[model samples]
Target: MNGLRVAVLSFAHEHAASYISLLHDRTDVELLTADPDFATAPADELRGRGFAARHGAAYVETYEEALAWGPDAVVICAENARHRDLVLAAAEVGAHVLCEKPLATRVEDAEAMVAACDAAGVVLMTAYPVRFSPEFATLRALVESGALGVVLGGTGTNNGKLPAGRSWFTDPELSGGGALADHVVHVADLLDALLGEEAVAVRAVTNRIVHGDDPRVRAETGGLVSITYAGGAEVTVDCSWSVPDGAPTWGGLTLQVVGTGGVVEIDPFGAHVGGVVAGGAEQAWLGLGENLDALMLEHFLGCVRTGSTPGPDGRAGLRSLRVVAAAQESVAAGGAVVRLTPSSAR
Candidate 1:
């Protein structure tokens, strides 16, 4: 296989650092990064962390410069609002794109990105690492195999208290929306993956119960959204940054999928590192496995090289974005039902 040249557009997501590490360790990829404020202190901090230069990677000052390297693909890790422009640019260059979730804040922008990629005949995959998790992947396989029979309903949640450190997540305009937008997609994408369908109707309710007093926080910290898919599957998504600092590990994400034969529960929250005591003492918790960024990167590169389509494509992104828009509309309408159609289901 030929080496796949890859570049990162921004480093604000906090996951940007992880992507750097993943790219550096891969022999099949050449990593590059770019930010307009490349010389800024925070950007310098990222550079100093060995992400920008480790293994001969370059940190360019502009996204166009990064693209000038003639990459086969680019990962859009910039803030939510910057996604559409980057995706369009990459697609125009005939490069496949792996953009972070929420694709874009507006549905029209998301649709345009998809259209651009389709016109270029390049892949446009969303960064939904959860769908690639081993357990979750197995669950999807089981569902596809009909081991669980027909799925009736599912529930997904994304909950956590304030970071106790820095938080760029509270800005609604920047991060898109609050808990509903951030958390809803995971469930939405997972349900879409499991059911092999997209959500067509939704009713949502959100609130600013936490982080409201802070002048710096620009979005609500918590809320819930309910959805019904056109495929006859129902899902409820719960999320908040108000879970309390001392809440238990399991309090964060409790994903449940129910089917005719059995059910699956995925508890992805925890704070333990792996270790064991001599006697009957404490056995340290094993954290989540592998680097999802690298895994996703590998899959994307493989697809690009082999001319295959990856999961959570442009249509999936548009569908998820529509759900987010519907949830917001539902919240604005006092939890009224909103309906939409995904291109795939159309």
Candidate 2:
């Protein structure tokens, strides 16, 4: 296949910068970026700070004009609320889509995005790049090969430092619910990839612990969520933004998966994986490949050429969002456990 031509729709999402860098550096891709109202203070500041790359790519005032650039696929990096409309538009225009996490704020819109892509007969992949992480892939292969025996449950944690530059992220409407909604779904998607099944229930506890000292923000700084998969496997997810600034250990994301035979632990920062051995714990660290964002771009382009389905497709994202929505609903309803509809087997 020839090189893949791609364009980005919005620059609101934090990961947009990373995507731009990936596209800029990849020789096989021709990248364009468009963002309406780029002169806004926030947008300009982001550009100055290097978050908005693809400065050479054509910029248009509206998305419709941007789509006319002849992109083979579109990367929808808009705000959570704008994802549904943007994805539908891309699919309608006959372009495959690579949308950021949390496909849409609502399940109904997510379903619509899925339907749009299905009707258009183009791919609609969600960015759950964690599945491609070396540690995660290794653990998944082990479990699938029965090296870990029957699976039981897993524990995942990602206590990232607070987002500093992006002020809009504090707005629940713009960024979605909070920490649990932001981070837990990534783990849910990863669990689905590893277990080859969907999550069936969610029971979560969320709280707004940060006063935003600025007195103007009210985003959550931390939370815990427990998810139950269809095969009876459970996952305890812990995420927060409380890690202190400039600390040597700025943030950490780790996972511990248990099986009938043994346990597997993954430390993403170091790309390390460890297993419990007879004497103690044996560990191995993986070499990084620039970062996950670059790897994700490569995977997407490869899938486009090979006619392969991206694992975290629109339906997969919808499944994760259903679990997230159930978790949010559970938290609102006094922490009551919520039962989710089984995902349609894809």
TM-score to true structure, per model: 0.87, 0.89
Q: Tell me the lDDT of model 2 at 345.
A: 69
Which lDDT values do the candidates have, in the order given? 0.76, 0.78
Tens digits of per-residue lDDT, candidate 2, 126-244, equal 99877777878888889889998888998999776666666656667877776776787787887878888877777878766754575546666677888888788888999777776
Candidate 2 lDDT: 0.78
Q: Write the per-residue lDDT of candidate 1 for residues 1-346, one digit (tens) a residue.
A: 5678988887656566677778777877877888663343233344322545653557877888988888888888776877888999999889898888888889899989989998999999988877776768778888889988888888888886664322445667667887777777767887777777777789888877687787867776777788887768888888787766544332456678899889988764443465665574655445556656667777887888987889878778878888888988888899899887656542
Evaluated at residue 99, the lDDT of candidate 1 is 89
Per TM-score, the best of the predicted structures is 2
lDDT, candidate 1, equals 0.76
